[model samples]
Target: MGDGRGGGGGNRPAWLQLYDLVGKIGEGTYGLVFLARPKQRKGCIAIKKFKQSKDGDGVSPTAIREIMLLREINHENVVKLVNVHINHADMSLYLAFDYAEHDLYEIIRHHREKLNHPINQYTVKSLLWQLLNGLNYLHSNWIIHRDLKPSNILVMGDGEEHGVVKIADFGLARIYQAPLKPLFENGVVVTIWYRAPELLLGAKHYTSAVDMWAVGCIFAELLTLKPLFQGVEVKATPNPFQLDQLDKIFKVLGHPTPEKWPTLVNLPFWQTDLQHIQGHKYDNAGLHSYVHLPQKSPAYDLLSKMLEYDPRKRISAAQALEHEYFRLDPLPGRNALVTSQPGEKAVNYPARPVDTTTDFEGTASVQQPMSANAIPGGVTAQSMAGPRPGPRQISMVGMQRMPVGSMAAFNIPSQAGMNLNPGGIPMQRGPAGQAHPQQLRRKDPAMGMQNPGYPQQKRRF
Candidate 1:
């Protein structure tokens, strides 16, 4: 199964050769995603190849978990797993999917420098509609997209103006077969920026509402073009009123109390040991503070409801779709608005042909040095060793070399110089690693300087 070049590890089954791999589309901890074309089909497809461990364990459990969940779920807004391929020799697994143009993160980055024509309100509504629709489908199926963010949403077919948006990456999604429990012992489930307050408060039993909180944050970011609640420090601290962002939310929406948020005091972090800081309001604020605010319109109201402090009070994804925001003139539609941005055009490319070699042989290529930034915590890795249970950690080297489609499947960041290597492995260091905290602290240029409602936390899968 191994190509003489050490490229193909004979990890892919013979039947999988029916599809031609064009090139690397993305890379992740466990696998490489490639732009592939089925020999019999006309359009392109995304082929995710999970690196197999030398031992019996083929694909990482994290990948298996994602495949298992994605297989059973189908919705227009959700990315579909077209097929799976298993290679017996190396225990590798390949997942095929419909190809997409770009992820929301890429779109945001492309438009970061431009302010006048930023994603219009209509476009935001359409994307939000699709996101909520996908979430609704997942929640209805008793699944939770623990990680929901711009990076995870892939733009397909040509969104309303440019291409359609599809919710991708279900690696962290879990089924709600029983009452909710602490999925992670350390309360480190979601990403920092889009994480919900309840998660930070250590609430063991939660619901789909957690996803709504993230959606709210994303909506605000869409309007403001920056993360709503990126805390100053990595280590959690009780800075109740210091963050001007949250204070602005209270100023516009009013403060919340135990009565307003009944479970606020019951959260794991809200015990008597947790200090109760008095509320504060923003005074003498300038126009710059609220310039990005959506006109006092229905979209604004729905955004407010989604960002509600009380998870119970949050609007359901289905309910949010029915809101008037989506009914506005030039109704939000599927497909992205096209532009002349670099890498935006859909290119017609040929697929990479499969090698006709018969025997599986190991090549002598030297393993590349690991990247300085390892895969983040919670990401699973594919081991060359025996099968390990639960989630495995993907290595940084594996990620950089991973195929494009696989990278999309795993929601890896697309920044050119960012070190996506997992586990802090210091093979290659990039500007992202050298970026100062202050540089990271700058607000998302797309969202601008205006504080929009609650600061959204990152939702990790």
Candidate 2:
């Protein structure tokens, strides 16, 4: 295990050289999860490798945050952080996880392409329930797993924990949030398709409901074997406001409005970003055409609540677990991969393709490039350089709340229309050469309120 902090690493550990290291099994926002087999151990385990932060000085802030927070989390459905190791020699930090043979993406893809086998409803129920169970625990403990997608979830192909569902990839997660920071500072989040309506509206502050939105998207994908809202993402800016992605959501879920969401109009980008499509015809009658679930069924009920446009109204993980969907005739099983009930024959999925070319010599050849589509709509989230910087409490003048004298007079002109960055809190300040969300330089005191190019009079307070 190499132990170099910024440049070179510590001496390579003998265990790393001895393990039957295999090729990559999966990739996530900040790291690569691969398979490895130790000569003395029984089965395979996952070696999640994290690259150093921006300067390549050491493990990224996101990796440290994940390693610290995940150490305290314990649940059957959650991927356990077995151990933390570092190779100072190469400045790489590795987290060991139980090797799950399959992820929901692979399972869904197998059914859609290679195997062409359909996933039974039982498997869907068990997988979703278990995933929710893990989520419920996280939310209860005040932790938000900001990234939740089909590929982020892992499942075993065999053993006592066999057929079990384990949620992975906490690189974008946050714990014990207080004096909330704007969500955009980190960079693109939740992949475009699963991103919630509020986030698209440019709500600077958000809640756990964002995760539920992703879960809803996952539920739909599991049933249909395809992304429900397959929108093409626009990467024009480092933080591009997701116009195209929002268009996709509006087409399927219908346009969000002040009538449906009272706070919808209050979002910073509501007027600046949403003014283009005010006349588009839409129906709020909902999800029936998209999901095959019966309109009145409990599954449909759960899906609808999960996809609620208003983050405040969206269903919580705990509430969703108690939904009638789980009370049906065939209750959810313990294993999502179990092909049959007890005492009956079983059908197990094929092993995932593992690259057998892991470097046992402890010398580097080439590093695998980060995959943007690792989790469908998920992006390689821009990670933070360090811990959340405390913002200086400014005077209460501009921050003061005032009643709307006239809605017509309060039009905000934004030069950066709906600019959205990846996950992570907007740090109060960033390193000298780095850029942070909260560090937006304000040249004009009026900020973006007045259009500099336009000859409009500044609002008189």
Candidate 3:
């Protein structure tokens, strides 16, 4: 493909003509993520290149869903979909997003391994608050971000929006307000470490509470620089359940009881596999032993509510924002990097590294791009094939674009036709061509970290 500058008879795909591919930043199950420079624009853009769909269709449903949902919602805390493009050559799909330089995963890793100091209280509080704020918007719109791990939470770097948190990677997100099928039929969702207890046990029905559970786990990680639950995922087709994961949770939070969680007995695994799950009886709560916050502290109180046993009782994102935790001194700020306290110094977060090598080159013979109606925001590739038109506008009619954007377990009744992972892999977290798990490094919280009692993380999900 020729650079956007009109070389090679200007036969390059329209997407290539609009954005100059800088280099590949990350690769995942979907495809590859490239750092792009809009030929006519000043700032950078992260272009996600999706591979051909399984059926060799025009675009994958995941990409379409992301584009449709992003176009409908407009919030500073939410990652914006600048534009959608197609490489006519292979019929591959590409999504353009406002580049965010930092993510909570990288930031937490940096503070732990590089600086060797805990993140300031102000920064942690601010980051959490912004995360909840964005989550509140999604919940209000009936969108449940099934995947809310630390890596998916992006932080802006070196811009007017620097230090601001942007909730990203919506491939696994789903609109829970109404669904044609049971939410569980979609299969496993959240990453294992951050997964809610109800999901592990196979609850057949669920709600927005699943997301709040993930937020709680993220909050714990921000405080400790390590995944709160580091259980090894069983790779077999289906055995009992996520025994190690449930054990890990039970070890810390104590086993669930029907009294505390009214619907506990209704879960399929609880009724049928109770013997296997109840290997170790835990009667007392030991969460405080790992997290050092005072029991009476607002932060601890909020965390407890978020990690509540019952999904029905788990704290909502909106309620979490108004909790006493944010009401305390050193309140959250818009820019998480900037300290909210009067005299604290802002932590200088390093910029994300970009790879200059490995640019994307399409393989299929060039073909006319798909119709504009199929693409999000009513933008077509053919319209971009012509000469450069003024300064490039990545997001045209951004907010006005399109309309805006589960659980349960149980049953020993019959295992036939369940949405079990026959391959035994965790659910695909993000889009194929988007970022993958390259930066996901396992750390031992027992070594010079806050949660020394917890076991070492052996593998990266």
Candidate 4:
């Protein structure tokens, strides 16, 4: 393979020749992410390298699904799939995407730990607005981002699209237009901390409301620099219903009842596991206590709607963008870093750190390739060890946790909103770069070079 500096890489894959593998960004159960600079183009790119199928057959179903879904859609708020390449020698898959400098996870950590202050109100509002805007686009098209969390939400660094929110990591995203099978049959979805109540209660049939619940949790995390509902996960085999996660939510929002959620009685777990689920009683409704927002504040009202107990009543992304909260002072702008208020300095968040030690070639050689099983949401067998830099960038693929929050009383219906149909747009790629091969090596043991259990399989809608 040709080194990134324009050498003889004619024998390698097209990607290895087109871009210089600068460094390894992060790794998960399925693959590793590399940060590369195009030899001919002026900008950088994030190349996700999927491990060869365990059976060495074809591409992993998750990768195939992501490619299919991403290829069919295009929006500024959504992450762009630049290109896809396959290494026939190993049957590995490589997906190239426009490089995003920072994710919500690091941005939040910077504010909480390094800067020692909460993210500015303007930034928060703008971030949330863009999030809903992008989500509305997806929901309108019948797509549900099964995994929506801070780590997967990318914010571009200094560039033409700086501070623009791009919803990345579509490995768990799905089109919810009448599926071939129940979504639950594929097993758990969403990170544990951002999971929906319906999922925790074991609802077999679900909708885009699950995404809205995650957005609500993200909104709360933006307001309060911590996970609104920080419940530890129970990582048992076959994924048992998360009792701790549900209890954590009930303590804050009060337990759900048949009156509040009419369809609550229909859930599989609610019917079969009623004793344990109802073992403890909670009656206090106190969202006001944690959020500290005034009773009638637009922010509070909008949040309450998003976290509604009944998934059917959960605020749709389209409806949320029109909520009074977004209409209040400091109106949302395209760039989240800049405050709308005059005389306010743009918040300069630190850029995402890149590990240059391990490039694509380096990673492939050291790591043991194993096919990800049919499990969906769980932490990797090993987390990146020695951390000596900025916020760690781990893929939140197939992780689970229900969205957490206390709720104030509000009336709701028994059904969710309707999906909108929008015309599809073709993808536009940046100018192509010249070919270069780079031989890189990795010395980090904690980078998760070995693939563990398989994540969930992809299902067609």
* Candidate maximizing TM-score: 4
TM-scores for all predictions: 0.63, 0.73, 0.76, 0.77
lDDT of candidate 2 at residue 133, scale 0 to 100: 74
- Model 4 stretches astray by more than 4 angstroms: 4-11, 283-285, 363-461
Give the whole-model CA lDDT for all candidates, comma-separated: 0.53, 0.61, 0.66, 0.66
Report the Cα RMSD per candidate. 15.8, 16.6, 14.9, 16.1
Please give, for residues 1-461, the per-residue lDDT of candidate 4 as tens digits: 34633234565555477776555677876789876656777666777888766665655767766766776545557877766666555556677777767778888888888888888887888889878877776676567889999988887765566677888888888766555567887688899989999998888889889999999899988988888888888878565778889888887788889999999999888888868776668876687677777868888899888889999888887677767777666667767886656796767665444555566755333333322121111111111111011111122222122121100111112122111011121334222221112212122221121111111211110
Worst 10 residues of 1 by lDDT: 379-388
Sorting all predicted structures by TM-score, with the top scorer first, yields 4, 3, 2, 1
Give the per-residue lDDT of model 3 (tens digit) for 171-214: 87776655656889878888889889898888888888899999
Global CA lDDT computed for model 2: 0.61
- What's the TM for model 3? 0.76
Q: How far in Å is the alpha carbon of 68 misplaced in model 4?
A: 0.5
Could you tell me how far off, in angstroms, the CA of residue 297 lies in candidate 2 after the best superposition?
1.3
Count: clashes, candidate 1 = 67
Candidate no. 1 TM-score: 0.63
